[model samples]
Target: MKLLLKNTRTLTENGEFEACDVLIVENMVQTISSFIEIEDVDRIIDCQERLLVPGFIDVHIHLREPGGEHKETIKTGTKAAARGGFTTVCAMPNTNPVPDKLETVQQLLERIKNDALVRVLPYAAITKGLKGEELTNIDQLSKLDIFGFTDDGVGIQAADAMYRAMQLAAQNGKAIVAHCEDNSIVYGGVVHDGAVSKRLDLPGIPSLSESVQIARDVLLAEATGCHYHVCHVSTKESVRVIRDAKKAGIKVTAEVTPHHLLLSEDAIEQDDANFKMNPPLRSKEDQDALLEGLLEGTIDFIATDHAPHSSDEKAQGMLHAPFGIVGLETAFPLLYTYLVKQNKITLKQLVDWLTIKPASIFGLPYGKLAANVVADLTLIDVEREMNIDKHTFYSKGKNTPFHNWNVTGVPVLTICDGEIVYEEDFHV
Candidate 1:
């Protein structure tokens, strides 16, 4: 079968746009040119000069399946990823009945195989049941097609445990992704330990809670020669430590979430639960450092940290609500509107952070648009504008703070392995 995507445009070397047509045969991109006329094409999509690029990849997302189906499932979550321009997403291992055992891992694999709309690479939990007490059988679990080992919802509280996990993961050639937070330092904080917390009369999660852990793990990573990745870095100090580690030649990479990049504690404005998140929105200074880190290559890439929760849970106000927000449906458009259009960064830089940068760091053979490559692609209509509506999202969780925000650079169509996975307002 032949599929033709015509009148679309590709981003040029100079960050300009160039018109092109992409032809796919089976699951591989056959050719990309200014124009191609072919007979017996099974399908032709008029991209209408929309931007065509390698599908975006988010290495940090919570699919919340195998147990947390009330929040999100594989089918709904992957559809949300596709709609947000992500053709590939890495699922965090923080579900109920976490993927520490091989049997449980197999259950998730089967779910992905049967229900995923796009590519879903899952990670094995680092500790048994994510209790942070006993380490999982990393040697045995690494033999599977898992991306790495992580107990993402909560940080491993014990230094000895993390060091040992890193050693085991390094021996097996797996990355050790971490959620860096010190529960001791956090002290039941809900918002950031900043003016927002002080004025609101609520407990605050200090930067030390996030940064101290990063400092510790980077050292462990260096000693073990492991690829240590920091998830949802939200502090200037966290960026400083990661920056220092990279300078010292430690095998380290870090990701900054769109929420952290776009909003700070100052943006909270009120005691709202939707604005609540782990590694909570920090001071504007910390937010600035995060952008600088991304620009200077200190921060490896962009991830949404797309945690979804029920509306009822989120309605419990700032202190009682779960710490997360739905991100898959609004990430690209939000970033583009806030960062790219504002001229804080170029559009090419944004695309790279979302695609090639993360893929390169993770050693995934994706995030490129080239001949004879798998046809994992997204067509984005940059000129189109729409207000983000939570009710319209494919994700079950409508817990985003960016509701009703106007934005562009939205993904209109997504293809995975030469098959149409998601197309806006159309049946795939």
Candidate 2:
């Protein structure tokens, strides 16, 4: 099929343009020129004044399928990813039946191939059943075309286990993504263990719960010679740790969720469990540090950590509720509206964080609009303004704290592997 997208601002690695025509043939970009004279084009998307970008990629998302289909399945989660302008997403294997075995990873691949709206790359669990005890079959699992390995909902508390896992993963040429939480220090607490938790008389989850583990992993990774990635870094101390690790020349990378970068524990005072998440949002100082890290390029990319739990699960009070918020559907609009428009970050930097940076970190063949690259693209109607509406969400979960928040940009069309997976104006 031949697709022509014209009158759009194409976002290149260098910068943005006023207008260009993106020509696609099948699953590759045939040409991106000022004008194209082509015959027998199957479709033409008039992206006048809109921003055409390489479809965003999320390296951290929990599909919760092959287990918690009630919360989110491959179909629902990937639809959410597509609607959020993501052409590719990596699913962390902390599912009911952990995807540590090669057979489990293969099953997930099949499920995603049949059900997902966008590409879903599975991340096998670093340990079988994610028990953090025995290591998963890295040799076999790595051969299945998976991306990275992570016992993601929890840090492999055993240093020996983690070191061994990283060594094996490094030898296999795979990266080790760590949850970076010291569950031992977390002590089963709920919110950030500070003013908000004290005032509400709730159990507190301390900042060190994350930072301590990040510190430990950095050292271990240095010794193991593996590419270590810190997931959803939320504290100032964690930022310093990652920064120092990078300085020390460790093969390290880290990501910050939009919630942690934009929101703080102050929002928790409003009594909404939706604000709740694992490594719960921290203090204003922590938020500032996270933003500083992003501005200075210390943080590698922005991942939604797009954890989706059902309303029923989230409805369970703050203390007993599941820890996460639905982010994939709202990430772009929120970031573009807040960070880009405010000039805290440039559009090019923002796109790179969402696209190229992530691809680089995970070593995927995505995040570029150049010729012969996979034709995964996201067309954004930058001029469009809208409010966050859970009703329009494609995922089964609607536990986002940003409900009703005003957002200016939205994805108008999403194309994956040359297929028009999602389009706002579907009928036309």
Cα RMSDs of all predictions?
A: 1.4, 1.4
Misplaced by over 4 Å in model 2 are: 12-14, 426-428
For all candidates, the clash counts are 0, 0
lDDT of 1 by residue, 60-146 (tens): 999999799999999999999988888999999888789999999999999999999999999999999999999999999999989
What is the per-residue lDDT of model 2 for residues 276-366, given as tens digits with 9 covering 90 to 100?
A: 8988988999999999998887899999999889888888888789899989999999998998999888889888999999997777889
Off by over 4 Å in 1: 425-428
Model 1 lDDT at residue 245: 97
For candidate 2, what is the TM-score? 0.98
Model 2 score (lDDT): 0.88
Question: What local distance difference test score does each model get?
Answer: 0.93, 0.88
Error of 1 at 365 (Å): 1.0
Per-model TM-score on C-alpha atoms: 0.98, 0.98
